[model samples]
Target: MEKEHRAYKSHCLVLPYPSQGHINPLFQFSKLLDHKQIKVTLVTTRFTSKTMHRGSSGIELEAISDGYDEGGIDQAESIQAYIESFWKVGPETLAELLEKLSSSGCPVNCIVYDSVMPWALDVAKKFGIVGAAFFTQSCVVDSIYYHVNKGLLNLPLTDSEISLPGMPPLEPLDLPSFVYDFGSYPAFFEVVIGQFSTVDKADWVFCNTFYELEEQVVDWMAKFWPLRTIGPTIPSKYLDNQLDDDKDYGVDLFRSNNDACMKWLNEHPKNSVAYISFGSFAQLGLEEMEELAWGLRRSKSKFLWVVRESETAKVPKGFIEETAEKGLVVSWCCQLEVLAHEAVGCFITHCGWNSTLESLCLGVPLVAMPQWTDQSTNAKYIRDVWKIGVKAQPDEKGIVRREEVEHCISEIMEGERGKEIQKNAMKWKDLARKAVIQGGSSDKNIDEFIATLVKR
Candidate 1:
């Protein structure tokens, strides 16, 4: 009877930051826990929950009001104000939800919260539940933030080139876009820095990356907190080729028009299409957008581009009609499915960690143009550490011109550099597969995490 009662304690609440990038990996983690027979409840904002495609799955979907459920932080006065509101309102609602769960007799045993939402840790502690911080970004970025919290690396860094305890030397250009001078966007830096401060409160620190990918950063991070690698938290179909009943993550915020994209790719020759997407959030100026459109047109390579409906207005007149035969543009896509296509020769990306991992895992080289946040850092790893991509340098106005874009597209498709990058991508692909299989690094780490949770 005691054992039977203890078995019911395997319920976990997953709280991801309400964004497409943050939500996807945590959703994958929830599915993984469910595979281990742990009951999972994924919490989302009212607006985000409505947008997500929560099909039949073992994980229960729960919604919490984040004040601006309709417009989200976009409706807030400022970024600082939005964050303040999120922290203020989110904890209260989450606490109430926990109480409701307890009263219903489905008490949560563990609360796995996105590291970005550090305040959630406090909510979990208040409810006397085990708290774990899940970092959805690269381990190197986490390590950089950890150093920044320690005051070892002063921001608005005095020296242009800065070296940290475990990471490669970084230039101001290489740091996450949020880490500007003290006078500029201080609140953004504060919020990012604050994430590390709450780490000691968490029972475990989970990274959505494998050991071989960022070994030094992971080792350095473990010294501070109990850490584990249970990623790349991608769908099983893509990673291990597991043909489970529920293979897709089924959490697309936008409708995935994959059928058209995949059919278009089928028409192209193998390794022929240059796939372009700047992630879901990053915005481009009209001038830059036009430049990219012209560049893709001039490059003459067959391509697929994912741009927002709003941003599509910025394209130069007749650009799409001119390239209709050679190009395909869509508002949103099932990115994993697109990247895994055999015709995708290279990726032109914003260097978001998800895009980075997917490209590398599928053995597709990159043409990196980092926009903001951890993107520049991820680009640094791609161009410098991983050697599986090339960075597109912006011009005097910080815009990647048509010439540069055309050059990068051509460079990655043809030449010796492209060959070397392809080789590296294939190598990383093999390593990524090894990390997810039975008895592999990620699998063992996940098992250890479950054992610890059960023991607690």
Candidate 2:
């Protein structure tokens, strides 16, 4: 049912970069604000609004054009072209949205824009309202980008190791792929680095991480920006359950097979199945997929894997049917529900921030198979700092061979080391819950954000 419209002390327009990973956190944060009686309007591109599966969360939804009203990035000539077009068109549409809202007696008081699109803050400023930059990545990752943006970290890094403020020394392999490989996905590298362009001007900077989880980097960032940590932005049901109706993230770019996945998990024993997924965007080459498939077979452990429909053809012929008695493979499944299931032993993941946070929040150990971008860094933390998982090492060909994949899975799903990792995972899970529950670190930061909006 649609929620009743009611008067609120402040109206905040939440804009996320148009992607499943980017949209989910911002939407979850919007739900929290709505629960606090802050009027929240979530804005998506016309294309995304048309394609997304909208849940009945009832936060007001609005749409602005990203220039391709029919199809978003897929319609563009290139990533660079798409980004340039969106940059030019996004601000104009956003200003129009502001003008429309103002004339309707519901003027926006703030715009919490995805940091990737710094132009949104410019629109917020043009309308004379508070602008908050919301970063959907970890603080350590953001700090790396901020340094690169400021020229503190030089590209084509000459050193084997990097030492930065409030972060542990990192090997070149441990840095984000954009930084380590430089010029790979140039457009996306620009987007990540460009986030700092107008960030100093934003009234507040919010990161989707709890303070306790990233205390050092968060503290370092706070010194330079009005930074606040308010996340692990999954549904409240997975965290604190403070928002009664908060279950799934209210939007998804793809449909999931919840019933089939849950049924498969129900048939497995506790902590017996390895849950494998490469997230929405990462695509494994056919050879890698074959290796992963064979590795699952060789591990002899029951497993559940999510292979996006586009990538399903790459799966080895007859692999699914051959492994049918021991495994289930689907295009997509409700991730949180699968992670929360007692049968899911360890996650073999791409280590995307959203997936990492989900596994961490749900107390699932990991076998990190990092593909690119921030996944490597997250995997580093998963193995080193967090001690809740093991990172799979790839060979010189840059493929995690079946042997290594099988080894990592075994390491996490069996033996004394697995027990320690499971213990650490549960400890972080409790901390995650505490951070989002009443009077906790993330909850307090959110309260401060709302309080500031009301005062403004």
Candidate 3:
């Protein structure tokens, strides 16, 4: 670490994918650094960042953007155009920002990037400071994809019937059609294949998970990369449990409709309401949406769903009204608060890593419906390894089945086995809390990871 006499103020830029799940971790990560007394600039597309506050109070944000704020693109066409433009124009924006910062007295010395945004590695190289790419998924799952793409899989299976030995086989019935088919994740797979190369370009690869959640996978990643796992970095947990009455320390880094969601969750019983959401970006078809809607209705349990405007993927209308009184479906919900609510019993999620960790931290069980990408791997951990949830099935092309959805929902919420999973959920939840508590594993890991970035 840099000594005070020769040391300079540490400057870092946090770049996240313009999606909700991607932004949540990025925000939490920046907060964790701030807690450690490091200077950070958290950047997001101006459009997405607007959601941070419904009505502005004029409070300063980490840092603002300039020259083509990424907020204008909406819908598939706009998104595609923006991405193409991003690929062609993104790096220069980063470089220009760094140049501006350096011109000011406080020059940026390092960058912490979302692993998917390899452009960050280039930014770090440009400034000649260490960069760490945050991998938001379990390393184990990423390794499987990396190995599979590199011809590591000689499985008799040809299609997406992905079954790792000793791990549960998550058929298309349980995963998104794209992942079951493998070819569907063209962009994600390309990113996965290119992930290792980024490690060489980075100072290290950081994950928002701990050793307990993924012992083997982290070990594997560490062999080839300077992998650092430190997390469950929610700010609320740092405060005393009795401080629920306290005001939020700062704005939520991501935009989620908190007021309505919190009221709905507050009404449910301790360990009773089933929390459901498919983090952002996994588009769902009508049949799939209906299957989920019907299955949740059949489960005869209360639920809070975070469904974005694009959620239905053009599904029918009556479903939401059909269960309006018994269900709460919002465009977005404050996930950490919902999970922490004593009323939330189990989580019906797409098994995105961020969602997975939140459920684990709350110690709630899962109804795993991994839409695409590493979701299958995350689902495996929830069902097979963690033993905290059941995997819902998907159809031939990778949509979830109603029966599978119904069965898993019933099993997780009311079945005899559900009771057992809930019990384990509580146990794991405690461990998660311990991991983040002072002197805990996560705490130590963060210290170590920061040590790597600390200038000497």
Candidate 4:
């Protein structure tokens, strides 16, 4: 008797929690799966799905697929509150997609879940699909995330010093944005953590950082969760496709540039350029913005500043004219490429997760200027954990001063401390490369993951 036939290729759905930081990594992991010849079903909120799949450069998640719906924040306490509450609809939305694909004779093999969302595991179990968790932060941060809810945040002592396993204990002032400030307005930390029900229950967990980048912390998390570190994913992929002959990747359609910035960098010496960006989500108050401008002007360092159109950015009038000759302000530039450029010596950043990882992988030290959300968490790691960056303080209105900014930049670039961070950053870079090589922990884990994902 003849047996029924199986599908042509294995397919896995990759879903990020729907933010630029989440979207970028999920796209990388999905592409990595495709590279291994597995078919992909990339999932996103309706809006992000449109943004991510808008290119011929990679696999696009089709809206025509069944169960596809417009993704929006739920009508909960707040959008941040909605992140956790949205899980109630996860099973339903996922079911629609599954039923649609099955009806079309294509059954999903497994799921690659974002570690932040635990509900993915439940949906995976319902369909007998393998649930894989893709962790977006470094393992150092991961260990903290896994434990912060377990009596850490509930510590009764005010301004208590907390010690992470690998580094020295930290004061409340040192704890970046996500942990302490979450009690304040519009905090996602409270909601997201409460709803982190799916990720810890997964069959396999994948991390975006390579093993060596967070070796000690990665090793520690392995006992609690089935962990795999597979990052420097963005830079790793970028290096693969860049051509020696091409001037730019031509992915510039997404970027808006103001080129006077590049011209300023051209005039500066190699490794002398200070590139300033507060990252995708970090914001500055009006006072902080002007102070930073004046600080950059006073530092005597040739600089490139990225002016993102965020709600918090308040640019003063006459500012452009005052600093135009020495400083270049641009909407955006090819960030990874710019960091990798020899002209970039120091980075002034808000320490978003991606920016921290990217700058670290490129061996560039940072002058951390974290604003809110996970920016503080990332800043803590960059400043306290990694010893590769310096932190800038926020004022009474929660804005840091211009003189302090100038002093901080000078301290990082020309003083004895700046030299130290540069040294440490290069050390991290060497290990990052080592981790991506064959037989390395990250390399082995990625190979094993793709094998299981495609074969099972």
**By TM-score, highest first, what's the ranking?**
2, 1, 4, 3
> lDDT tens digits, residues 1-456, model 4?
111242335778877776667777777666656655667777766544544424333443643211224445423455654554466666567767777777655578787877777777787888888888887776666666556666655533365787777656776655645666545644566544543455656888888887665777777778777887877666344333321232232222245553555556667787776888876556677778888888888886777888885532476777777877667777777687778878888899988778887888788989888776556677877877688988888778777788777877787778999889989998987777667666666667877876776666
* lDDT (10s digit) by residue, model 3, range 263-287: 8778777766778888766767677
Alpha-carbon TM-score of each model against the true structure: 0.95, 0.99, 0.83, 0.86
The digit string of per-residue lDDT tens for model 2 on 186-216 reads: 9999999999999999999999998989999
lDDT of each: 0.86, 0.93, 0.68, 0.69
Q: Residue by residue across 1-456, what tens digits does model 1's lDDT show?
A: 332343453789999988888998999898888777677889999888877776666567888878898988788888888888888999999998898888665678889999988988898888888999999988888887877888877766788788876788888888887764444667777777888878997999999999999998888888878998888888888889642765566787777688999899999998899999998888999998999999998986899999878688887888888899999998888888898899999999999998898888889999999988889999999999999999999988999999999999888898788999999999999999999888889989988888878886
What ranges in model 4 sit over 4 Å off? 1-9, 51-53, 63-77, 80-85, 103-106, 152-159, 185-187, 237-254, 258-264, 311-313, 395-397
- Highest lDDT: give the candidate number: 2
- List pairs with backbone clashes in candidate 2: none
lDDT of 2 at 313: 93
In model 2, which runs have C-alpha deviations exceeding 4 angstroms? none
The local lDDT score (0 to 100) that residue 431 gets in candidate 3 is 80
Task: Name the 10 consecutive residues with the lowest summed lDDT in model 3.
Answer: 54-63
